[model samples]
Target: MNTFLFSLKVMGIGLIGIFSVTVVLIIAMVILTRLFPVSAEKQDEESK
Candidate 1:
């Protein structure tokens, strides 16, 4: 029983760590998107 409980605890901690990393990546993507805005006119000009 004790070993089962320990395994459960380890799994919970691993889930938390994965969740934290996902959140960080999402936040980073949002910040980068805001910093790099795309414009249609800019693309047309660059193509010429």
Candidate 2:
């Protein structure tokens, strides 16, 4: 029972760490996209 509880604790910590990192990365991407938006010309060319 002790070992099971320890394993669960470790897994929970690991999951939380992964979720935090993913959220940070997503936020960074959103900021970067806003700071460097695509040009109208580029959009037009891609549409063709």
Candidate 3:
């Protein structure tokens, strides 16, 4: 029972770390996209 509880605690901590990193990455992506807006003309040219 003690080992099981320890494993659960580790898993919970790992999940929280992963979630925090994911949130940071999403925010960074949003900021970057706003700084460098994409042009429709560029997209059309690339689709050729």
TM per prediction: 0.67, 0.69, 0.70
Candidate 2 local lDDT, 1-48, one digit each (tens): 999999999999999999999999999999988876788558878999
Query: Could you give the C-alpha RMSD of every candidate to the true structure, in order shown?
Result: 2.9, 4.0, 4.1
lDDT by residue for model 3 over 1-48, one digit each (tens)?
Answer: 999999999999999999999999999999988876688557878999
> Candidate 1 on 1-48: residue-level lDDT in tens?
999999999999999999999999999999987776677557877999
The TM-score of predicted model 1 comes to 0.67
Q: Give Cα distance to truth, residue 10, candidate 1, Å.
A: 1.5
All candidates in order of TM-score, best leading:
3, 2, 1
Q: What is the lDDT for 44 in model 3?
A: 75
Residue pairs in collision within model 1:
none
Q: CA lDDT, every prediction?
A: 0.90, 0.92, 0.92
What TM-score does candidate 3 get on C-alpha atoms?
0.70
